[model samples]
Structures are given as structure tokens and as C-alpha cells.
Target: METSQTHENSIKLTSTEDGIHLDGSILWLDSKHTGDISFLSNPQSATSKLDSRVIATEETIRILESFRKKPKALICQYNRPFAIGPLNMELLPSGVGLGGASLWVETNNKKILYAPQLQPQNSETCHHMQVRKADILILSAKTPYNADANISRKREKERLIETIKKMVSANERPQIFCEPYATGPEITKILSEEGINVAVHPNLFRILKVYEAYGSHVGSYIQHSIHRGDYDTLLKPIPQNKQLRRVFPKNPVISIEDNQGPRLDDGLFRKIDERFYIPSSCDGRELKTIVPKIKPREIYIFGPYAKDYVRQLRSLAPVVKALFPRHLPSLF
Candidate 1:
């Protein structure tokens, strides 16, 4: 057996789980001085009234710490090679192929969704799960904030409604969408109409700076014209089949995010064989980048309202909303 300890930070370690003292120093210490920068949602408050409440637990420490390290790109694997000393620390689930299963615990008082990623909430089924009424939705803001395509985060956007405002139950805890900043007024208005208390808080203070730099709205648009069955106007610019071009309803705004705030090039709408490509421009001269790096063959053509990519895809094929598996009625 090897050894591990957390003395002056500068962590030290070993392999054997034995030969090491299992006193106050090394109970769950699977590793040496390894540490994480993380936090958990407040437990089911004693004052709140609900049947079941979910509070983030020990995993919170690791999840946050992993993020504090500013991971390069998010992945949805359970067994990466990161060393965790000896605590047997398993990284929190990114909720990718796991389907609709979430990483957070919830109480009846609130529909708490511990979304590992902080991308826009757009899943209709996942949003519908909030039918039970949610008081809070604690989102992991850093999850897919700087995400790349062909990963779990990309899939979640397809599976879950990308609209952050509707992530929580429209009935539960007044519906709080916690991220790095505030929720859009349009979203707040919807929740208000449903009598759900709703607000968006920064999942981490570090994220707040980003929102401040941008507009208060960190997320893009909610109503994707392409997804919403409006392809006529959105498709006028495609160089492809002209028949496809006449199919869309010309819209001044490509989508909500495009209209309300700065967003990734709207041209990014198709998923072709293992990659997500979008029409991107480097220094005003636009080009299609394979998500991070545009491909040479990609025609960086801007569509109506500057959305050539999405319009082209919509002009060619119809994109559908993802169906989130509904929560089973509780045993209670």
C-alpha cells in the first residue's frame, strides 16, 4: 500500500489504500493534498415546505474544484485519468448519455435540477418536467459555456430545451434559473404568468464577470425560427435548391439570441457525421469553422439577419425539438 496526505497544500500521494493511517487525516482521502473548488446548493431549508428536496452533497466539492482548475473542454466520462489521491473521488456526471438522469438531489419544495452544464435550457420535455412546480434550478454554468460540439453538452442542447428560463418546473419554487447572471425579462415574464417565482443567479461569481462584459443576458434566443417551423424568410439566401429557398417565412430576427444579444454564428445548425459546423467569420471575413476550427469547404455565407448557416440547414432539413423523458409520478 502507498501513502497520501494534505500538509502544506503541495499535495503528496501513493497507490496502496493500506499501510496508511485511517484516522482523522485519511478517512475519505483517496488522494494526497488534492483539493477542489466547489460549492453545494443549500439543503432543503427547514422553513420551506416540500415533500422531497435535493441538496448537493460531497460531490459538490469535487465538481467545483474540477471547474476551478478551468478544465479545457467538458467531457462526459466517468473514468478519466485525473489523479484523485486516495479519496476515490469520482467526477460528477456530466449527464450526457446517461439520458435524462440529473446529478442533483431535489425536494418537493423545489424542482431542483443540478444541471452539470450551464448552457441554454431548451429541452421541451425537460422543461415540461417542471410541471411539478420548481422553486430553484441550480445549473452548472461552466459546463458548456465554452463548449465544443460532438460532445455531451452538444447533445444536451438537442435533448433538453436550450431555453434556460424554462428549465425548472413552471409550478415549483418560483423557478430560479441559476447561472452566472440574470434571466431575460421575456423568460421571467413567462414564469410570472404561471405564478412561479423565477430568477437567474450566477452559478459562480467568476461567471458574473463574463455576463457583465456581455449583456445581462448570457444566453442567446429561445425561439429558434428554424426549429419553430418558420423557414421561409430564413432560407432566401441559400445557394442550394431554389425550391428550398421559397419554404421559409422571412424573419427579421434569425432567432431570439441573435435578436436580443450576441451569439455564435446563426449559421451553425447542421450536425453532419460526428461534427457540428457553422459559418464563422474571422475578422469580418466570415468562414465556416468546424465548431472551433472552420473547414475550408464550408461556405461562410451569412443568411437573413446575418444567419446563412442555420437558414441553409433549415432550408434543406427540418430540425426538431428534443423530447426529455418525463419524471415518473412519485411513490408518495
Candidate 2:
């Protein structure tokens, strides 16, 4: 446990066997934790098995219904302040995926912001990330410091559209594999705006319906059908089986993978005509730019590559600490 003096009082920050604790409240940022009150940050966290009073954004609660997993969750809207005991908490858009948010808590003249999966970039299907000054900032350090971090999502989207056009022109069916919750909706919205016919997997279709309910313009899409052969493009999750060639033998297969996950081996899909990569997430360079704007008095890094993030942010923040869990508790 670490104690920091605030204007009129002191704030307690600690990581215990349960999870990250701010004062006495427990935070479940896309992780499961046990406490009286568990503040969830995103859809992933809301659906987690948590034996506590769960609180999440309104969108997240709706998404949970789509998954058919109901937990008694207290709903709150973005930028709206709600009280839980002595803490005044508000949700801010995290800009990572659908229904993603950052938690901001204020108590005793001190403010703390918890954002585990933050992306400052705007998406066509989701809200832009909102930043605010805080006394303490707990951030995730998952993005690697590399050249791929600098790739522009705008250019990548354009490139993906062009490639899909070329594949269609050559009488090939372009199958795009992406993460269902994060990149799927954005890509679908972009392709739909371009007037391209897109078919999504059943699970993704359910999620898109939730997004539509929240007023996100995901455009027009049909659920993927094994019998239908009219769509120009097909969007689905990464396949566990490599023998996809046998399933769609009528059209020449060209797979365009969203580089959000592991790269598929060439031998796994020998029949694939071509493959392309499009990655997402806020990189190390962007994190540096975002932190200064937030103007946090103290910063704590957690998640993958915590040491690297700590080193990079040490000079930018007044006090930078790494919260790498020794017992592998899911702090993020």
C-alpha cells in the first residue's frame, strides 16, 4: 500500500490479493475481483464472474444482455457523476472498443483515473477517448514500443478497402478475420459506408445489434450464411481450423487478417491466395502524448511490459511507479 498526501487529506492506493484498491473500493478493470463494490470498465469486465455489486456504463450493461450474461449491474452514463458511499465516480469513453470506458473517482479533494485499455484515436463506431487531469493515473502498458506503433489507422483503413476492391475485381471473396468486440464493428462501418456488401458472423451480428441500439452507425450488414453467395466480403473471427479452403471452394480465397492477434502460419492456410495485415491499439508513442495532456501528478503502470512503460514515462510524470503483480492478479 502507498499513501499520497492530497490537498486536505491522504489517499490510499494498494494492490492486494483481490485487485487494485482505491481507498476501500475495489476496481475490476476487465478482470474479476471480490469486493462489496466492483467498478467495471468495459464489456469484457462486465461479463466477468464477479461476486460483488457491479457498476458499469449503460452501453456495457446492454452489451452484457447481448451475451446472455446478466449480472446485477448499476448503470451510469458517460460524464455523469454518481455516488457510491463517499466516492463520486464518473465514466469517460476509453475509445478502445464498443462500450469501453475509463473510471474517474473523486473523494476528499483528490482525483484518480483508471484506464487499462485506452486509445485516444477516434473510431467510426465508438466514442472518442476523453481526458481529464488527475492526482493519480493507473494506466495499462500493453502496447509495444516499435515501428508498428506509428502506423496510421486512417491509411490502414484505406489500404484495406483498396485491397478488398482488388480482390473482388479478380473474382475472389475477401474474408476478413478480426477481433469481434474491438475491430469488427469499425471495419464493418467503414466497408458499409463504401457501399460494400458485408456479412458478419452470428456472434458479431449480435454485438452489432447492441451497437445499433446505442446509435452507432454500423451501416448495413447481414449475418454470415453458409448457403448465401451474394456478399462481396465476409467478416468473421479467426478460425481455429486451417482447412477453410474446402468450405469455400467455389471462390478463390483471399484472407485479410486484422493484426490484432497472432500471425497465422503460411502452412496453416496453404490455399489462401493472399493475406494482409491491419493492426490497432494505442502505441507507446501515443501514450506519451496522452499522459502529458492528462497532467497527472502521479502515474502507475500495470499490465504487460510495465517496466518498459515505467522507463518511458518516468520523465513525463512527477512520480511514476510500476504495479507489476507478484502473484499474477488481474489488475487490468
Candidate 3:
């Protein structure tokens, strides 16, 4: 389901009685959108080395050819609307890069934020410092922040609170999900009193243990323990890992695992360079400023490259860039 294929392109995902056909760098799929990780379990089969010369023409042709053989219905998600085969693409805020086009939505219903996989420290400014209104912010609040020791100690909770103050109107109310931290718990307790829901998923213990801990918590909001590879960079709570080098701090008393690894870093997002992105969909103009400033070297990772959206980014100017991850570096 994942590939390093990037180009000035349009995607068509068709679902037929047989299976789904993805007409992009990927071709067709013969199953529900269960996800791409399971099929590509082997490192050899899943990973591909891709560069520009082949990106636009050759790679596009190759994947297009692959889909020709599948023969299924087609569906496309562009900007706000989506198209399924012949159906018109509907208009709704869309999410990019975080698996499919669903991430750009936030409903008013009693909702749960399932953020996982990304290192929290890296996005301290983008995720925490910025105010976003969510009924519940299900942070990957794993403790004993050994993986990236520098971030484990960062004042992320305070930043998130400050950001929230900037976002929600004075009358709005929301809650926070957190882990059992000296400060996070206290802050949540205070917020909960003011009508902002502050709750924690005790399952965070699995992330704090000395060993690669495992546990099953049949809870309302979560399922399996988030994988090291799949957690969202903006929402994932920090974990203990090799990023810390030496650990076993006196404060937590958690042990270490020999096979532990660091979260994905700069080297990971480089594969498929996109031209346009939809960060949050609030301000279209601001989104434009975010592009090129962070990682100018990388190609536009879906930066309103299409003739249609490109005009929107320029028109929105500053807000359009707000639709994507503020902290992650640009890719080429």
C-alpha cells in the first residue's frame, strides 16, 4: 500500500465486485482498505529505491500499465471531494500522506484521536505549540521518554495547552487524553474541571517498561499497541528506545530493551515526493507559506501542484499550507 513513487499526478481508486484498483504509483488492490503494512511485511518486498528521472514518465506508465490489467471501478480523492469510479468526488476536507484521504476530518461527535508512531519531540512546536480544537487529544503519552531523551523532557503539555487557547473560541469546550505524568495528569485534572475532558489511557505502561512490554487493554477508544513504524508524527506519545543511548533513570525506574529502535527520522519521508498537502483546512492562505520554508531541498510533497489546487494555494497564500504537518521536513 506504501510506495516511494512521486509525480505530478492524479489518483484513481476503483472498487469493483472483485477488488479495489488504485491507479497511481500503485495499481490495483484485491481487498478492503485494510492497510498497506501487513502485505509488505518483508523489508525486501516493500522497500524500493526511487529517484526523479523515473518518477513522472516511466514510473507513472509502469503503474498505469499494472492497473490496466486489473480492470475494476475507479475512485479518486482530490482536494475536498472524492470520486469513486464514475461518482463525483465529494467535497470535504481531505487528509494526505497518513494513509488514504481521511485524516483531514474532525467531527463534533464524541471523538477519539488515535495518534501514534511519530516522535513527539520533533513536533513540539507544530503539534504542541499550536492550538487545535479536538474533543479529545489522544496523545501517544507513553512515559519514560528514553527514545528521544531530549524530547521526553520537553514541556509539550504546556505548549499544547497554549496552542489550544489560541485555537478554540473562548466559549468552546474540549477534553484532553493523557498518560500518568506528574504534570500532564495535573494539567488534565485542571482542564477537566473547566469542562475540557482530560483523560488518560493507562495502556501507556507498555511503553514505559524496561523490556519491550506487551499488554492487551480492551478499552473504548484504542485497539492494538501502535507499531513503531505507523504512529502519526504529530500525535504519537514518546517511548523509551535507543534514541536515549543510556537510560534507566531514577525517576521512572524503567528498564531497557536491546532490540529497541528509534522512530522514523528524516531518511524515511524522502521516498515519494509530492506537490500538494492539506494540513488542517482552516486557513488556505497560510498553508502556502509553510511550503519550501522547512525543507526547500525536497520536492513538493503534494503542494497544490495540480492546475486546480495550485491556484487555490496561491490565492489562499498563507492558510493553504496549514493543511499539512507543520514540523515534518519537505521531501523531494
lDDT, candidate 2, residue 254?
Answer: 48
Question: Predictions ranked by lDDT, top down?
Answer: 2, 3, 1
Instruction: Report, for every candidate in turn, its global Cα lDDT versus the true structure.
Output: 0.23, 0.71, 0.23
Per-model RMSD to reference: 21.8, 4.1, 21.4
Q: Where does model 1 exceed 4 Å of error?
A: 1-79, 83-88, 96-332
lDDT of 2 by residue, 1-332 (tens): 32222222446565544456664554444445555567777765443466666778878777777878777778888999888777888989888677788888888787888887777767868889887888888886654544255566677788888888887888877777676676788889888888889999898898899999889899889998889878899887655453453335555454545433444334443466555545445766778888887788888876556667778789987778776556553222
Clashes of each: 64, 0, 50
TM-scores, in order shown? Answer: 0.18, 0.85, 0.21
Instruction: Between candidates 1 and 2, name the one with more favorable lDDT.
Output: 2
Compose the digit string of candidate 3's lDDT tens values, residues 22-132. 333232222323232011101111113211111111112223233232212232222343323332222111121111111111222222121211221221111111222
Residue 81, candidate 3: how far off, in angstroms?
31
lDDT of 1 by residue, 221-325 (tens): 122233353211111111112121222222122222211113322233321111111111111111111112211111111112223233322222122111111
Q: How well does model 1 score by local distance difference test?
A: 0.23
